[model samples]
Target: MIPKESRNELALDTFIKAHPHLLEEMKELSAEDRQQQILWAFEDEAESRGLEAWELALELIAR
Candidate 1:
Protein backbone atom coordinates (compact mmCIF):
# COMPACT_ATOMS: atom_id res chain seq x y z
CA MET A 1 0.00 0.00 0.00
CA ILE A 2 1.20 3.52 -0.80
CA PRO A 3 1.83 5.82 2.13
CA LYS A 4 -0.44 8.85 2.49
CA GLU A 5 2.60 11.17 2.57
CA SER A 6 3.72 9.79 -0.79
CA ARG A 7 0.24 10.39 -2.16
CA ASN A 8 0.75 14.12 -1.61
CA GLU A 9 -2.99 14.57 -2.10
CA LEU A 10 -2.51 14.11 -5.85
CA ALA A 11 -4.16 11.36 -7.88
CA LEU A 12 -1.78 8.64 -9.08
CA ASP A 13 -3.28 8.68 -12.55
CA THR A 14 -2.89 12.43 -12.80
CA PHE A 15 0.78 12.29 -11.90
CA ILE A 16 1.42 9.44 -14.32
CA LYS A 17 -0.32 11.25 -17.17
CA ALA A 18 1.65 14.39 -16.44
CA HIS A 19 4.97 12.55 -16.38
CA PRO A 20 4.65 9.46 -18.55
CA HIS A 21 8.33 9.37 -19.48
CA LEU A 22 9.47 9.74 -15.90
CA LEU A 23 6.96 7.09 -14.86
CA GLU A 24 8.27 4.70 -17.49
CA GLU A 25 11.82 5.30 -16.36
CA MET A 26 10.77 4.61 -12.80
CA LYS A 27 9.30 1.26 -13.82
CA GLU A 28 12.65 0.24 -15.27
CA LEU A 29 14.48 0.93 -12.03
CA SER A 30 15.03 -1.43 -9.12
CA ALA A 31 12.91 -0.71 -6.04
CA GLU A 32 15.74 1.05 -4.24
CA ASP A 33 16.80 2.94 -7.34
CA ARG A 34 13.29 4.12 -8.07
CA GLN A 35 12.75 5.21 -4.50
CA GLN A 36 15.95 7.26 -4.50
CA GLN A 37 15.01 8.80 -7.83
CA ILE A 38 11.62 9.78 -6.44
CA LEU A 39 13.16 11.28 -3.34
CA TRP A 40 15.66 13.24 -5.37
CA ALA A 41 12.93 14.48 -7.66
CA PHE A 42 10.96 15.67 -4.65
CA GLU A 43 14.01 17.36 -3.22
CA ASP A 44 14.94 19.04 -6.47
CA GLU A 45 11.39 20.16 -7.11
CA ALA A 46 10.92 21.55 -3.63
CA GLU A 47 14.28 23.33 -3.74
CA SER A 48 13.49 24.86 -7.12
CA ARG A 49 9.95 25.88 -6.22
CA GLY A 50 10.45 26.69 -2.52
CA LEU A 51 8.94 24.67 0.32
CA GLU A 52 6.15 27.17 1.01
CA ALA A 53 5.08 27.12 -2.64
CA TRP A 54 5.20 23.35 -2.63
CA GLU A 55 2.90 23.26 0.37
CA LEU A 56 0.54 25.68 -1.32
CA ALA A 57 0.51 23.55 -4.46
CA LEU A 58 -0.41 20.49 -2.46
CA GLU A 59 -3.22 22.37 -0.74
CA LEU A 60 -4.56 23.66 -4.06
CA ILE A 61 -4.47 20.21 -5.61
CA ALA A 62 -6.19 18.64 -2.62
CA ARG A 63 -9.05 21.07 -3.03
Candidate 2:
Protein backbone atom coordinates (compact mmCIF):
# COMPACT_ATOMS: atom_id res chain seq x y z
CA MET A 1 0.00 0.00 0.00
CA ILE A 2 1.11 3.56 -0.62
CA PRO A 3 2.26 5.57 2.37
CA LYS A 4 -0.53 8.13 2.37
CA GLU A 5 -1.22 11.13 4.57
CA SER A 6 -4.16 12.77 2.78
CA ARG A 7 -7.57 11.82 1.43
CA ASN A 8 -6.61 11.58 -2.21
CA GLU A 9 -3.50 9.64 -1.39
CA LEU A 10 -5.36 7.22 0.83
CA ALA A 11 -7.97 6.78 -1.86
CA LEU A 12 -5.43 5.64 -4.41
CA ASP A 13 -3.76 3.26 -2.00
CA THR A 14 -7.14 1.82 -1.01
CA PHE A 15 -8.24 1.46 -4.61
CA ILE A 16 -5.14 -0.35 -5.71
CA LYS A 17 -5.33 -2.61 -2.70
CA ALA A 18 -8.88 -3.65 -3.50
CA HIS A 19 -8.38 -4.04 -7.23
CA PRO A 20 -5.06 -5.62 -7.97
CA HIS A 21 -5.86 -5.96 -11.67
CA LEU A 22 -6.40 -2.22 -11.85
CA LEU A 23 -2.96 -1.62 -10.42
CA GLU A 24 -1.51 -1.84 -13.91
CA GLU A 25 -4.23 0.46 -15.23
CA MET A 26 -3.56 2.95 -12.48
CA LYS A 27 0.17 2.92 -13.14
CA GLU A 28 -0.38 4.33 -16.63
CA LEU A 29 -1.89 7.58 -15.44
CA SER A 30 0.09 10.60 -14.34
CA ALA A 31 0.14 10.89 -10.55
CA GLU A 32 -2.35 13.74 -10.53
CA ASP A 33 -4.74 11.95 -12.83
CA ARG A 34 -4.51 8.74 -10.83
CA GLN A 35 -5.23 10.57 -7.60
CA GLN A 36 -8.22 12.27 -9.17
CA GLN A 37 -9.75 8.95 -10.12
CA ILE A 38 -9.12 7.54 -6.69
CA LEU A 39 -10.61 10.62 -5.10
CA TRP A 40 -13.78 10.12 -7.08
CA ALA A 41 -13.93 6.50 -6.08
CA PHE A 42 -13.30 7.31 -2.46
CA GLU A 43 -16.08 9.87 -2.50
CA ASP A 44 -18.41 7.28 -3.93
CA GLU A 45 -17.59 4.83 -1.18
CA ALA A 46 -17.95 7.47 1.47
CA GLU A 47 -21.35 8.49 0.17
CA SER A 48 -22.55 4.94 0.18
CA ARG A 49 -21.39 4.55 3.73
CA GLY A 50 -23.18 7.74 4.81
CA LEU A 51 -20.00 9.47 5.80
CA GLU A 52 -18.04 12.45 4.55
CA ALA A 53 -15.21 11.75 2.13
CA TRP A 54 -12.43 12.88 4.41
CA GLU A 55 -13.95 11.06 7.34
CA LEU A 56 -13.82 7.74 5.60
CA ALA A 57 -10.40 8.45 4.23
CA LEU A 58 -9.06 9.20 7.67
CA GLU A 59 -10.71 6.15 9.18
CA LEU A 60 -9.28 3.90 6.49
CA ILE A 61 -5.91 5.55 6.77
CA ALA A 62 -5.80 4.83 10.46
CA ARG A 63 -6.28 1.15 9.80
Q: Which candidate has the highest lDDT of all?
A: 2
The regions of model 2 sitting more than 4 angstroms off are 1-12, 21-28
The parts of candidate 1 lying over 4 Å away from their true place are: 1-17, 52-57
lDDT of prediction 2: 0.72
Q: What TM-score goes with each of the models?
A: 0.50, 0.58
Supply the global lDDT for candidate 1: 0.57
The per-residue C-alpha lDDT of model 2 at residue 56 equals 79
Candidate 2 clashing pairs, residues 3+ apart or interchain? none
lDDT of 2 by residue, 1-63 (tens): 544565556655875687676557688899788767767776787899999987777777767
Error of 1 at 16 (Å): 5.3
List model 1 lDDT by residue over 1-63, tens digit each.
Answer: 546656553533343355577667799889788767765665565567666535634643575
lDDT of candidates 1 onward, in order: 0.57, 0.72
lDDT of 1 at 18: 57
> Worst ten-residue run, lDDT, model 2?
1-10
